[model samples]
Target: MTKLTSLTIAEARAKLRAKEFSALELTDAYISSIEKSRTLNAYVVETPELARARARASDAKLAKGEGGALEGIPLGIKDLFATKGVHTQACSHILDKFQPTYESTVTANLFDAGAVMLGKLNMDEFAMGSSNETSYYGPVANPWRRKNSNATLVPGGSSGGSAAAVAAHICAGATATDTGGSIRQPAALTGTVGIKPTYGRCSRWGIVAFASSLDQAGPIARDVRDAAIMLKAMASVDPKDTTSVDRPVPDYEAVLGKSIKGLRVGIPKEYRPEGLSSEIDALWNRGAQWLKEQGAEIVEISLPHTKYALPAYYIVAPAEASSNLARYDGVRYGLRVPGDDLIDTYERTRAAGFGREVQRRVLIGTYVLSAGYYDAYYVKAQKVRTLIKRDFDEAWNKVDVVLTPATPSAAFAPGEITDPVEMYLNDVFTVTVNMAGLPGIAVPAGFSEQGLPLGLQLIGKPFDEETLFQTAFAIEQAAGKFTAPQWW
Candidate 1:
């Protein structure tokens, strides 16, 4: 008998519809896994009672043959989303006990589609940092370890917990946000499928604001089909979010095995940056070969602004973060430390509440947005951002999709890189897509010398997630799923 937790969402859904197992059984299996895997610290808050209740409701719906698309699929919600009345803190102490009365548009859509909530997964505090180390809830240990080494590794940021949970099989999929590669990088590290849909594909309304312009919601799942299904439920135009495009959502799963016979795949010259690992480079070339074997035409294209994307992303994201996070000054909600005066209270509360990484970004953001340095840093970065987009726009004319390594290297043990600059380099390959507001999917392609998982990213045109699903499925068919040898 296979463990229920090992089944992907697609498999679980089929079994549930065939009456092979109850949603209650599925939910209980996940809850038991969550309880046992607490040492990983993937979940900041456990909502067992809520999950059970939702699972029962789903069972009832299935009994009536009226189950929604996600009918009974259990999922972890990244702490960044507001899950009405449940713990939703974005894994930051500044948002202490901050549970919303209304649901985030993405999570709300999931719930509407009958997805059960496992709990709030851990993340970088206020979605800052490349590693999960900055979370006020503590860092999430990657489910995968180097072969024969007991040393724990990071699952990648800020969606580290989301990626870890999926890899650990605590949930079938997870709701994750990408503000400069949070979703894709973590997925790459954990060997899960993650998609950062076009910027407006998922609504920003009700999500804890973090570089709002760059932030978008997507799913981290065990496989590409599950990711496609989850995204179909998670993405929709919402009246509450004006940024959400008013386009009709397509059935992404339906496009999975579609032929890419004449598909043009762009191999970016700039993506082979200075320090890319040979293992990752070989894996990227292998992925390209696999796609080409399936009839994709590989073309060498250049996005020259790719080198400037990371620095500009740092400037733009933190600047917006500083502005967005300004509301957490202890006056309204969350942690508040009193001071001798109102100004002092604001200063004390912020300084005390925010983690070190969060504080660093806020200061950088404030400095960049400050009057004297605005044009030189923030405004100039915005101009660079435009060039980044134009670079992608130009590439689209020659290629249908862009193929690149998801991360420069495989998962590294936590605290391996102490320097902030070194850590920021993790996003070197992923940030460009975010800057361009393009749809990107990370699919596990191979492993490293240490036997940790590595992935290749597929970047598609804006609002063209269906094409990404199609291409990613072809890669998945070739590389197959890589699961951790369960150590927990």
Candidate 2:
């Protein structure tokens, strides 16, 4: 018999229905896997009791021949989402011990589809850093190690733990939110599949806000087929969130194995920045060739305002973050530090609660949104954001989807990047998709020279995730699935 932890969600679903193994047995295998892989620090909280209870219930449902789409699958939830009566902190000191009475719409949808919760996974505090080091829970270690190296590497951030958990085989899939490169970057680094759907594709209600306009929820899984299955269970239109799209959620898994013949695939010229690694460049060229062999027409295109995406994202995201995070004062909930007076108390509480990166971003946000600088920074970034979106809007006239390297390189050592600006550059290739409110999927394409994983990104039209799945499957089939050597 295969190790239960190594089976993908689709295989488990079929075996579960066939009564070959009980859901409780499968859940137990994952619980044991989590216990053994503690060095990765992927999970911040372990809800074995809850997971077992859910699995037993699923077993009963399966016995009755009545189960939802995700009927017996166990998944990890990112700390950013609110799970009723469970720890819901965004891996931040500020939200210490905070648990929501209400559940996030995305989590609720997953549960409605019969998914079981493994626990809350770690992430960057308030979804701020490019690497997972900013988490109050400590950085998540990538399961993959460089050739002949024992040095630990970062799994990429804000969805670091979600990606790490999927890569490490501790969870069937994970719910991850991407504000800037959160989902795709981590997946790229860890040899997993991650998708950030269009802005309104998933509801933001009950999930802790990072940047209102930029944040969107998606899934991270072992493979493209698993990712498609999980995304179908996670996405829904919620009346509680005004931004949630009203369109019907399609069966994303249905598009797998579809032909991409004559599909015009756009290759953005601006993405090939100077100083790009030769390994990444070669892998990218190989990806285009694979697509072309499958009858996809590769066309060179331009996203002229691509250079401005990073700076504009920094300005716009923090501006909204400052406003959204204001509700976390000592008076309401979470941490509190009493002081001389009301204002002093506010100052002390926030200072004590927020981590350094969160504070830095909040300060930047406050400074940009201040009286004199509002028009100069925030408004200007918004304008630049529009132009960035316009560039994609124009490109849509020529191609059905755009392709690019997911990251500049593979995973790096935990503290290798100390300078803040240098760390911000890690998101250079990924932020544009968020800025444009487009759906993007990162599929593992090849390995770096040091044997670390690298991925290729696919950007699709608004609410057109089906095409992304179709195209990404082509890449997956060509490149073959990648897995870590299981040193952990």
The number of clashing residue pairs in each candidate reads 0, 0
lDDT of 2 by residue, 1-488 (tens): 79999999999999999999999999999999999999999999999999999999999999999899999899999999999999998998878789899999999999988899999999999989878999999999999999999989999998999999999999999999999899999999999999999999999998899899999999999999999999888888889999999999999999999999999999999999899999999999999999999999999999999999999999999999999999888887788899999999999999999999898889999999999999999999999999999999999999999999999999999889998888989999899999999999999999999999999999999999999999999999999999899898
State the TM-score for model 2.
0.99
* TM-score for each predicted model, relative to the true structure: 0.99, 0.99
Candidate 1 TM-score, true structure as reference = 0.99
Candidate 1: tens digits of C-alpha lDDT, residues 260-372: 99999999999997767789889999999999999999999999999999999989998999999999989889999999999999999999899888888899999999989
Per-residue lDDT value at 345 in model 2? 91
Candidate 1: which stretches are off by over 4 Å? none
Q: Which residue runs of candidate 2 sit more than 4 Å off their true CA positions?
A: none
lDDT of 1 at 150: 95
| lDDT, candidate 2, at 488 | 81
What lDDT is reached at residue 358 by model 2?
91
